[model samples]
Target: MLYLVLAVAIAGEIAATVSLKLSEGFTKLWPSVVVVAGYAIAFTMLSKALKMGMPIGVAYAIWSAVGVAAVAIIGWRFLGENLNPTMIVGLVLVVAGVVTLELGRMH
Candidate 1:
């Protein structure tokens, strides 16, 4: 399904981003490889989902937004990054926007 493909793309993107931080400016070998591979797979999956009839704008929006949120959570949990109340609110708004876009397409 297109949605599943999109989810995969988003997950890959998040993994890539998290690995990027661990890559330490590309000086780390394994994490650097992971970053590159994850991004490649993410883009490949995204292209496939687009070919499956999902609108580019919708797919890209969902992909980027979800990727951002997932990466933020990963950073918070694993990278000692902090999320203040404002940041949490902003993330919620992003989720709401994604939900609104999905709902709009249902009719």
Candidate 2:
């Protein structure tokens, strides 16, 4: 259940981030609204996950890792953004770090 809430939080964060880009400096109305709503949902869900007994470190690591990877993919595949090899390597490093953190928590 904690993981589930964290997943929802991650989705919200991702949507909010994408909407932020589409908001065009807040010049667009609908996207701006989505940005606000998404962030609100994201933070609310994240706090709930924490309250549900997920360690702050572990939860945050997973959230940031997934969010970073997902947003990068969305930008590349849907937003015509460039995704270079260097960026891919950086993402791999981020995932690796998160994996290490999660695995260490079992000890």
Candidate 3:
């Protein structure tokens, strides 16, 4: 249940970030609306996750790491944004760090 909330938070954040890129400095209408709504949903869900007993350190780490990875993938695959080897390595490091964080929590 807590993880479900966190997943929603992550999805909302990813949507918000992707919409932000498509907003064209807020000149675009629907995408801009999505940016606002998505962030609202993201934060709301994140708060819910926290209230549901997810530690802030773990929740935020997962949320941010997943968001970063999803947004980068979307940008590269759909938005035609540059994603080079360096960025790939960086993303790998981010994922590894998040995994470490999760693993550390089990101890």
Candidate 4:
């Protein structure tokens, strides 16, 4: 349940970030509103997940790692950004690091 909440937080954060990019430095009104609202929901859910007993380190690590990867993909797919081989390698490394952090916590 906590993990699900964390996932919602991550999705909200990703949506917020994508909307931010679409906002054109807040010049666009709707995306700007989405940016603010999405972040609000994200932080609220994330805090709930934390209060529900997800460890801070693990939760943050997973959150950041997944967020980065998801945003990168969004940039590539929707924003005309490059999705090159090097970026793929870097995203893989981020996932690996998150896995390592989680595995380390099990000990």
lDDT of 1 by residue, 1-107 (tens): 78999998888898889999999999999999989999998999999999999988889889988988888888998899998889989998998898889888887
Candidate structures ordered by TM-score, highest first: 3, 1, 2, 4
Return the TM-score for each candidate structure: 0.96, 0.96, 0.97, 0.96
lDDT of 4 by residue, 1-107 (tens): 88899999999999999999999999999999999998998999999999999899899889889999999998998899999999999999999999999999889
TM-score of 2: 0.96
lDDT of 3: 0.95
Cα misplacement distance, residue 15 of candidate 1 (Å): 0.9
Residue-wise C-alpha lDDT for candidate 2, range 16-46, written one tens digit per residue: 9999999999999999998999999999999
* Number of residue pairs clashing in candidate 2, backbone atoms closer than 3 angstroms, sequence gap of 3 or more or interchain: 0
- Window of ten residues with lowest summed lDDT in model 3: 1-10
- Residue 48 lDDT in candidate 3: 97
Residue 71 error, candidate 3, Å: 0.4
Q: Candidate 2 at 33: error in angstroms?
A: 1.0
Write down the lDDT of every candidate, Cα atoms only: 0.90, 0.95, 0.95, 0.94
Q: How many angstroms is residue 102 displaced in model 4 relative to the true structure, after the best TM-score fit? A: 1.1
